[model samples]
Target: MATIKDVARSAGVSTATVSAVLNDSAYVSPPLRARVLAAIRDLNYSPSLAAQNLKRGRSQLIALVVADLANPFFSRVVWAAEAAVAAWGYSLVVFNSDEKPEAEQRILSRVRMLSCDGVLLVPVGDSTKHLQRDPDEKPLPTVLFGRTVEDDKSDTITIDNISAGRQATEYLLDLGHTRVGSITGPLHLTTGRGRLDGMLAAMKSRGLAPEPRDVRSGEFREDAAYSVARSLLEQQDRPTALYVASGLMALGAMRAIADLGLRCPVDISIASTDTIPGIGGLRPRLTRTEHPLVDMTNEAVRLLVDRIRRGGEVEQRNIVFQPSLVVGDSCAPVGLR
Candidate 1:
């Protein structure tokens, strides 16, 4: 194994010079830098990240923890974060909390110990037990992504679900839908609950009471969404519009609608969240709420890097993105028969 000393000797430079060149700590002559690079290549020397972190008291790695990797929303969020972090010369480490506070806590502890630059977490629940809740003692620069809870102080980046939900339903209302329903994700997650709140708010605003029986909660999976939607479609007076909280769930909702010999705008209208781009092809472009994950991620990374570069106490900041409704063939003007 070629050590720093070996590279220094081969490059005919002092160990300190080699260190500065590798870490970009200080300006090194181009010739000297070139020599050091050549030596490193010839020796196949890899810089010791641990040692560098120890010396600087911080790591150039940002940890992003998500509740569920299965959710395309989270996946897209991570993808956006990755793109943004690299621009600032920082790397990202993705952790799947798996909706478990215990796992989230373990990962938090590990990230803290590793002296990571910062952390972006989508908390499983409202309580951040895994992370010490005090902003003054905030062990690190941490931002909560997509999941908002009790801690308003921690940096949060999420779309206003309530607003999005309201918007989705309002679109259906504009299309002459009076009996509107919704399929939400787990009530345990804030996103799910918040979206539900939006649906109710929209209904109330329009002088219609959102029926509880019409609303269903699922695991944010296609199967659960499918079964729930199928059951709903079996009702005597089925809902005219369904605000599906996810793109994946929309697929199930569409399938259920198809099974019942229903058509969009003709029978039931759908307004879903997150295009997800790849997995499923939503025909004629389903009316959807754009999550703005790419933009949110850019801000998250910017905040993380800023916190690391500029010394500051643990402070909570929230950046809420407003979702845009993309009108498509999935929704239509209801026919009064």
Candidate 2:
């Protein structure tokens, strides 16, 4: 293993000169720089980037913690974050908490141990206690993505989840769906709760309400949505339309409808919030509200990088993007064939 010392000795220069040449932190004479380069090439020396970054008080790595990586929506987030992080001259490190608060805490602990420059989190728990900084130490630069929690002071980048739910439900209502049902995400997280609230508000404005049996809550997972959809749709008096909360859950509901031999927009109409990769390829071409995924991710990275460069003196910011409804073939008028 050739050290900086070895390279310096071979180049007949002081260690400081070798360090300067390697880091390009200071100007070196052309001849001296050429000698150092020759010595490095002959010795096959590679400087430790981790050590160099540490000495500069930066890891040059940003941590991204998502609730469920298996979900295609989050996978898309990872793809966008990778590009955006690279654009900001930082590397991204990903972590999945699998929607468990304990797992989220453990991942945050690991992020601290790695000395990640900052974090972009999709919060799973009801509070941000695990992400709190020490009193004496500087606050970790963090931006909560997609969701939020209680007692949180960090900057946030999120979608208007309530508007997402309202838009999808309103679209179905405009299509003359009166007997509407829903398959909801867990009622605890902000994304889940706000969306459901929006759906209910939209329904109330139309002088309608869902039957108790028609509203079912499940995890933001395909399998869970499939099971819940199957149970909800199998009822003798099922609603004529459904408002699903998430894209993956909508896929599950569509699958369940297929297995049950029910045709969408005919036997029952479907509308949902959010869309994921390959969702546009479905036979019915799902009608849903779509998020500005790439734009939101880019903004999140920009805010995180800004926070990292300028310490925590700035006021906390909460940026929310709206969802736009994309009409497709899956929905129809209440009595349309």
Candidate 3:
């Protein structure tokens, strides 16, 4: 609880001399420096780093707001972001909105109150209005990660969702599956809508379309996907293949398929857009389009840091990374096995 003044008084020196020794900003005789160091140790005095950062108009903190922390996909994002932020000399503050816009609003408000230097956000809403703290003050430095919204100012780092969908569906089609279905995320988000659109487009290109009942929204949730996939597979004329929109949802679907006593690539084939931490170990490893999650997170942090340092003078940039198809035994050609 000792202040700099207390250290200076104990050291028998002016507070300025104490500060000089602490900051190493000015020359101090060895004797005076020794006294100051001794006083600091005896008094258990520690300077306030938050106060010092504030005086320089920085918090040395960056906020990373993800839509769903329970999802392993976002957990990977957090891991990558932590290292990327630290490499730039900033600590990371994490928040999970759980895919709720109200929670997103509150989290962004808290970020503003904490005066975070920048934000890397996985947007949960259709707009970025919450990022603007005050009409008079400038907008916070922000980079939207893995998603985009109705914001023109912030930079965006995203995967080609449409390509992800198209690639997965094309893989299924190439394997000779005629009746292909999909379990998708909420259609309101770009990740959901774009992937579904790509699936439909790929089907249309092959002169085919899914039945209205064949596609279901899984809300990007494991439990929801489990229920939906169970119901879809219970039908008498279910599709032979399913294109799951996300890795988490795919896990749920896989579990559902097992619960129903169905085997992958035999009774039904499954392909998905993203991959999670343990997905590689699944029997008949998932046939999916994999996003560069670590690279995307690093790029998002990089853009946010650039915006924080350069302010609005820098041009807004939207960077899109492509997904690569990783083939595995989860999918098999129809009538071949």
Candidate 4:
């Protein structure tokens, strides 16, 4: 109800003086500043964030776009990115695309309207043409998190998913499981394609080839993965070991295994590329590759902020973090469990 003009009138000071005192843009006498503060409290005046941002020429807001917020891995990324951005005196707004390119495009259009200072985007598949700006237009400061697009001109932060996939598959192979199957993410996305490629490469290294039917697309959804995994497990020539591309998919496959009245490692071993918080407490701890969540988030935020500050003057950076393997109870040597 109260405006800056009302505060200025109540404090017997010019509106410019009140503005200077509130924004700290210019030095005001201590007594005048005290009077302005007192008048602001008395008037219950609250500054308009839009007006403030207009005056400062910045919103001090960052947009984080993720494929699936329901996925714990993205949740961890949101948590870390929020903390890091808050420490830098900015706020974060999160958007979920549900792994759809059209949804991602809609979100980006909304983000453009918001005048966000920067963006951290985990792209959906390879559809990033919407992110490309005209040559004459100044590009939005953006950091691509987790996924990359072809001919990408923005900074990127991601784990080595290919290596992670290979490690998970190779671990099962080393344990003497020749018949290995996989539930892969959507192959349109690099995360899905890269991990599956790694798994296949690992299989090829040992002169082994998985049957075409053994690999199914989970589409990065738990329910889809559940169905795919259940079908895989129902086959007469089921794989002795299974490799999952993501933690969420792994959980689904585990549930499918339970529903089938089968035991992990005893009936069929399992390994995966990622794990979320609390995954360690699962009945049979998942054997998987772990991402540097904290480090990746910190770097993503830092890079976005730097890009926001430096704009086009900064060089684009592509940062890839290595994944670490955590062996757990879910995997066992073939015929030994």
Candidate 5:
């Protein structure tokens, strides 16, 4: 319970000198600085973060809001973002919106109260209405990550989800999978809509139309995907190959296939849009389109920090990363079985 006053008294120096030494805000004589350090160690004194932030006129805290932390993809993003922000002498506060717009709004409001310097948001859907600031109020320095909102003024860092979906579907098509099915994320979000659009567009190029029953919404939830996948697999004319939009949903679909006594790439092949940590250890390694998550996280943090430093003077930036296809053992040619 040693305060700055106690340390100052122990060091025989004024409180201002102690503050200057602790914060590195002003140069002190070498002897005085040594005495202050010795006193701090002796007294076990710790500077108050609130007081330090107040004196500096900034909290040096960044908010990172994600749609779902339970998903490994987002968890990896959080890890990388935390490390990136730490390197810049800032701390990251993570929030999960559970893919709800209202929750996202509430979190943003809380960020304002916490005096956060900037935000890195993965929006729930295409709704940027919640992000609109009043004309008199300064906009929060934010970088949208992993998802995009229409007409948003904030910087954005995302992958080409449509191209990712198209590539996954095309790979399956190349393997001669004519009756391909899909478990898609919610259609309201750009990630979901763009991916589904890509898959359909790729199928159209081959002069094939997907049946309505062949596509189902997983809402980016594992349980929902499990149910949807189970139903799809039970159909009399099931698709020989299945394309899943998210890594979490893909895991669920794999579970459903296993529960039904079906083997991947033997009865039905599977490909997906995302590859997450530890996914390689699965029974049948998933063929997937991979996002550069660590790179994207670093870029997002860098953009947000720059915006925070430059305020309105910084120009908005939109960065889109390309997805890479990673071929695994889960997919095979249609007739191979």
Candidate 6:
């Protein structure tokens, strides 16, 4: 069991000098660095992991917390972030908050215990206060992803959910879908509420009422959306077109429509968000509001590392990217309607 003391004793230098060398601090001279390396090699003195971590002030570890990993969008974000983090010589600790603020906060506490450099969080808005270690100052550099920072709170990196929602609805509108319904995610989340706002804005612009009955709420999951879509179809009259909150939720809605022997853009039309890679391979490619999950992840890691370099620096910044729509097989113009 070799330690810093042993390395120093063999090198005939102070323990401080050995630390400077092992941690790759620039203060040590080339001669001193060479001597330390020589001694470490001859003595087979392995640097203590705990000592190194302490000296570096960080274990070169980061945390990425998201709402749902099983969802394709979340998975793509995690993948992109992990790749970018590794390039900066840091490893990532992944956490699935399961859309629960309590779970996200619990993971944040554990990250605090470790020598973590920073965190990328997609918060559960209603319970977001749970993720805050300090109301005024953050205990670690954090980037809020796909979510908004609490008023004057953490830094943020988000896709324009509102714009995305607006775009989805506008696509339907351009196709002459005047009677449109929406299956929205629970309004407790910023993404959910923001997207819904966009939908309403588009409707209002067209001089239409954002009908209360036309919009129903569901958890941002497949099953919940599926059930809602089924209920919409059971009514005596249904919308000519529907806009769903998330891509995964959209899949469920489509399946429900299929079970009732309805057709897309023929019997009914769909415009929604989130498109997994698998969607391209579907017999009918899905039209969608496509967020740049990978790009957003890269930016989040970049911002976190910059903040970490400044030692948990304070800066209130928000990066919001707009999504684009892909007009695929799922939607059609209303001329045939």
Best by TM-score: 2
1 versus 6: better TM-score goes to: 6
Instruction: Evaluate all candidate structures by whole-model CA lDDT and list the values in order.
Output: 0.83, 0.92, 0.93, 0.91, 0.90, 0.83
Give a tens-digit lDDT track for model 2, residues 1-337: 8888999999999989999998798999999999999999999999776777778878989999999999999999999999999999899999999999999999988998889999999999999887865767776799999998888989898889999899999988998988889999999988888898999999999898889899999999999999999999999889889999999999999999999999997998899999999997897989999989999999999999999998776788999999999998889899887
- List TM-score per model, in order: 0.89, 0.94, 0.91, 0.93, 0.93, 0.90
Question: Which 10-residue span in candidate 2 carries the lowest summed lDDT?
Answer: 130-139
Per-residue C-alpha lDDT of model 4 across residues 178-228, encoded as one tens digit per residue: 999999998878899999999999999999988888999867867888999
| Per-residue alpha-carbon lDDT of candidate 5 for residues 282-315, written as tens digits (9 for 90 to 100) | 9798999998889989989988889998899978
Worst 10 residues of 3 by lDDT: 48-57
* Residue 246 alpha-carbon offset, candidate 5, angstroms: 1.2
**Model 6 TM-score, 2 decimals:** 0.90
| TM-score (C-alpha) between model 3 and the true structure | 0.91
Summed over model 6, clashes come to 0
Candidate 1, residues 166-224, lDDT tens digits: the string is: 88888888888888888999988878988888988988987997678889999877888
**lDDT (Cα, 0-100) at 38 in candidate 6:** 95
Q: Which stretches of candidate 3 lie over 4 Å from their true place?
A: 1-46
Q: Candidate 2's C-alpha lDDT?
A: 0.92
- Number of colliding residue pairs in each model: 1, 0, 0, 0, 0, 0
Q: By how many angstroms RMSD does model 2 differ from the true structure?
A: 1.7
Task: Choose 2 or 5, whichever is better by TM-score.
Answer: 2
Native-referenced Cα lDDT, model 1: 0.83
lDDT of 6 by residue, 41-155 (tens): 9888887657668976777889988888877778888889889999999999999988867777788888888868788888875545565567775557778888774563567
The residue pairs that clash in candidate 6, if any, are none
Which residue segments of model 1 deviate by more than 4 Å? 11-13, 23-44, 133-138, 311-315
**Candidate 2, 308: how far from true, in Å?**
1.4
